[model samples]
Target: MTLEVMARCSAAAMAALAVMMAVGTDTVGQDTETVKPDERSKVSQYGIRWTFSEPRRVGRFVNGDWWVVGPATVVSVTPKPGPAPEDEVTEIKRNQFGDAAHQDDRRMRNGSMIVIKSSGRQGYDSRVKSYDPGLSVQFPRPLKPGQSLISSVSHTSLPNNNFSHKIMW
Candidate 1:
């Protein structure tokens, strides 16, 4: 490559590195703030509609990072009705991490944040798989066994949001 092209590439990489370092240093030692008792105890509702993936059952399972001290229960899961069952499929996975697997257990339980992840992986080309316009969600209270329901999740990417947005300096 020419010197000019190499110089430009080097500059861009350095800029990205600096951003990561600054952001990493700021949050390295901090902990997720404690959430109020009311927030954890109360129930909220949001309806979601999106294509989802099913993970293969491995072996034994354990309570993961997203498990809080609440009475949360999954009612049911059904495929989208009609011929086109998978109009919005993203991807599928072999391992089921469970919700909140990426966050700390304590923080996920009693914190203000909710961490949601896609079951499947996205393709190399980001634009081709844009999951349509969107759908409104109503995340409701925990359900009972007798009650029947379907689960759906939605996610969107912010421009240039693949990396940390928080900076230290």
Candidate 2:
């Protein structure tokens, strides 16, 4: 088509669209009621936020499960952490089978912990069921709204099946 004809057709189509949108808005807005900010429901508020730092690409497991760790802060509005709802917690207990030196049974809530959230396997040939894409350090202690603790993930399991009680910086 010619430039003039195309421009006219485009202009006519835009005009019609504007008219339809104006009519639709008028009809839809008539039945709507203005909602105040204070009147909104607060049930969805958890009062906790996680601020993650730049992730470092840590070494990958032999099974092709790549891992990354970074410092994180857990900001909470209230002293007591949000109520523990069963639906939010995924309990995965790793039982010690053999006579391993590391016998410490750790829980996430007991103290500061590192939570690894993954997006699943990145490669099809990976032996691991999921991939450890990223991890964040969390504090069990309460934190004020503007307060944050300096924490990061560390590997305790040492070389040759040894374990370190203290995590070196």
Ten-residue region with minimum lDDT total, candidate 1: 13-22
Tens-place lDDT digits, model 2, residues 117-147 = 2232211101112212222223333332322
lDDT of 2 at 84: 26
Would you list the clashing residue pairs of candidate 1?
A: 45-138, 45-139, 45-140, 46-137, 46-138, 46-139, 47-137, 47-138, 91-120
> For candidate 1, lDDT tens digit of each residue in 52-76?
1221111111321122222243222
Cα-based RMSD of candidate 2 = 23.5
Alpha-carbon RMSD, each predicted model: 19.7, 23.5
Clash number by candidate, in order? 9, 0
Which pairs of residues collide in candidate 2?
none
Question: For model 2, where is the 10-residue window of minimal lDDT?
Answer: 13-22
Using lDDT as the measure, the top candidate is: 2
**CA lDDT of 105 in candidate 1?**
12
